[model samples]
Target chain A: MAPTPLAVSIAATIASLVLLFGVLELVRRRRLREKYALLWILTAVVLLILSVWRGAVSGIATALGVSYGPTVLFAVGALFILVVLLHYSTVISALTDRTVVLAQKVASLEQRIDELERGQDSES
Target chain B: MAKRCLAIIPAFNEAGAVGDVIRAIQRERPDVDVAVIDDGSRDATAKVAREAGAIVLQLPFNLGIGGAVQTGYKYAWDNGYDIAIQVDADGQHPPSEMSKVIDPVASGEADMVIGTRFREEGGFKSSAVRRIGIAMFAWLVSTIIREKVTDTTSGFRAVNRKGIALFESDYPQDYPEVETQALAHKHGLRLMEVPVQMEERQAGESSIKLWGSFYYVVKVTLALVIGLFRKPIPLPEEGGH
Candidate 1:
């Protein structure tokens, strides 16, 4: 009743190929620098290997002292979120500073205009 | 004869202590032209400044400190003032020590003079939060401008023609110390540091609260980085010589 060996092999081959294609796309789009692209490709390969070979994952989990369940996935997801949030905070802070400075510049210009108007009025 | 000096006091809702700041600066440097930028204060700050013999530039709406200071710089640059000093509206910056920053710029020694509390006798500010923020900002400023700046965010300072031109064109609005230094360095203006004493606020709560100060530091750091890489904003309609 189990799926044939050919079907499992075909699915694994397709998933791994997709992972490699994604890594290549990131590099081609210049979203990942060449030097960093190598690291990303390596990571994708490791993930593919772990998914295809159950023995590799169990060995990794045992070595790392983590239960081979949702725990490892959850930990990785949380780390990714934390990193993304930190990056976002940095970007937002920079944007706010620019806004504040720009606003100030606008305000100063307005003040100067007002002063000039008042000067002209007084002279006339 | 001593060089002509202009002290720009940028104020916003600082009616309580701005008068005293203007009066003290006048007492110290009677020859220095004092201009009070009343940044849409919903108080008698403008009247008080005028009554104290300071030329008042009343903004129709709140432009905050950066706007007020920029207005002063533009006036100084256009009107042929030899030196322009930025004195805070709050009484935190001592008027007596105004000479520390002004004299350097006036003597042709420095294009800009930053009053460095870091170099003061007490070493550095004691506020734990402020200290951490200052250190991080100092590092960031150094990285951005590729120059060493001990106190990256001190407000009380002085500038001459070179500085006047740069800041009159692109002064930062909120928490501007670090950004100002970055801009100055970018423009190849000479910057010097002088030891000057600062006093705690004399009256009224500081507009910069604890959390606000934290946010200010974080925001300013990012602004500096982005500003360095981003294209500058075009000068506003009121830009002048």
Candidate 2:
């Protein structure tokens, strides 16, 4: 609140750097899609800025009339998580619908091919 | 030109009853082509259906009833069948009573025909819980579609070419019976209900359970409400392949 501790500031900076690198590494490996990676990268950059500017959290919290500064960070983080999870849910629902359609199409085509092969066998 | 009819029986591990259902259709509607979509049944449902003189489209894995039924619609669309009749593989929908459902769709009176059990005085009616569930759906779907659909859960239905194209493109994944009517309405497809006799499952127990019924109602209600908000799919060009 009064002044940030050196150890805590150092820890936060390291953590933000680690987060940023982790996201970049995932993107490099093609593990995380660019669409989602962009979100994580933005989050990492914001954390990096907040960690470097010692007064930013407390200053923002005070402007918003919050007594506890870190609590505000946690609340905002939780809200972000909720929104991201909902996004995932919508994406998953779409994927599920497409998967079902693809399965149905594959089955129909397989049946047709089987029928055609049977007809060829009979004709020959 | 005579309208080519294809009977679609979506079966899942109903090997014991599927044969009888297929045989009945073949015997009664000899002119109608029967295509059984065996939804990855653990039993020999595909083989049995084929042996019974039905064309079996075997899925590599289980895709629930909705996906299985949609596959049948895809076949109807791909093969250009004029009418597609949905007959359950459990033998509940008697192939002899098939006309009551098929006639409306075949005659151009309705784009889709739902064979309702509530219309008749006697048949293998569902339990109290299922009746309540069905009644709730009947009220909700009828209000949404502005049509009296007595049996919202009846699988014994028939769809014309328009209905086939709609379902082949989009269908709900689970418990699709009730929501499909709303979808049909949104797509501007005319629906009709005809009285039909349904038999008890010839071999296995009913697939529905108490908890499953609760889930079914909640999920379908959500689907219907969401359906109201979503834009309706434009019906494909009439008589267009």
Candidate 3:
């Protein structure tokens, strides 16, 4: 028996929804952050479309002389790493600024204590 | 009413020895008015100080030694007292020798007088841990301030108008002794020390345990050393009276 068009469409839709939910779960568990989550969700939706219409993607990859599987995997991996590194750098900058503020506070406190000591000694 | 000296005693749950300390100071120098700063005491320290005829200034919260003493300085400054003495409520510092520390200030010879235990035959006798801590702190103070301070952590001290004004304005809240010494030097105040013997605490155990003492010394030493490089703090508007 041949696969019907309605059955193929339903399977494609289900596969797309499952991939979207899986990506969102990764985000919720912090295995992925917001930026990476958006990218992953988009990739998964595109992959679902390609899985349904493999002929178009294969045609494009063949014209570009690249293996479709390896190319897509590399694109996703690179994007994830770049986004995470950018996030880490932002965090480090914030921590450095906080450390500078704390050092200033400590210095100010020391000076105030010094002034008080002088005042006391002179009074004596 | 005659102008009398106000002795500020910073007490923290010193119930066992606070009464005796108050009575002893009163006996030694009855002319001086005493105010015990009860720093959120959990025990009957407030009652004991009051029973011993000391005016109790109950802090709303615990402010440690620095905050408690600063409150006393503020009280003395506001009340028009001629002098303020920062004496421990613990019996470690003998009330009998309070006069020796106070007389110099009374005679106008020194602006601040610190009771130096090292000057006497028997110096401080805490645990070996505390002794090493004190010595290291003393070294740090001496190096930064260019004065050979024998006692860097002695609590028995007296302050006149200038000293009171200084403390009232901006006193330190942690590891005060060494920081106070460096501050005194920076302000160009006449700092002097007198020979006095300090006894062990009569009632409670020392708040600084062995490991705590080590941390205290290291922390204060680093603070004082860092303070040496920093610019001096500007005097407050109502300071140096």
Question: Which candidate comes out best when scored by TM-score?
Answer: 2
TM-score of each: 0.64, 0.70, 0.63
Q: Assess each model's interface with DockQ, reporting 2 decimals per model.
A: 0.04, 0.05, 0.02
**Chain A TM-scores, all candidates?**
0.51, 0.85, 0.46
Compose the digit string of candidate 3's lDDT tens values, residues B1-241.
5446998989999998889988998899999999999987899999999998999998755767788888998898877777888788878888888999999988889888899888778756666766777787788778777877878788888878777777887676756877888877877768888999888777766656666765565555545654565556565455333
Alpha-carbon deviation at B174 in model 1, angstroms: 2.2
**How high is each candidate's interface RMSD, in Å?**
13.9, 14.5, 21.2
lDDT of 3 by residue, A1-124 (tens): 1222455445655767797778766644445544345545665666566546645444555666665433543454456557657867996896687677668767988999999999999999
Alpha carbon deviation, residue B31, candidate 3 (Å)? 0.9
lDDT score at residue A1, model 3, on the 0-100 scale:
17
**For residues B66-149, what per-residue lDDT tens digits would candidate 2 score against the true structure?**
989999998999888999999988888999999888888888999999998887788866678788888888999989888777
Off by over 4 Å in 3: A1-124, B1-3, B236-241
Cα shift from native, residue B102, model 2 (Å): 0.8
Better of 1 and 2 by lDDT: 2
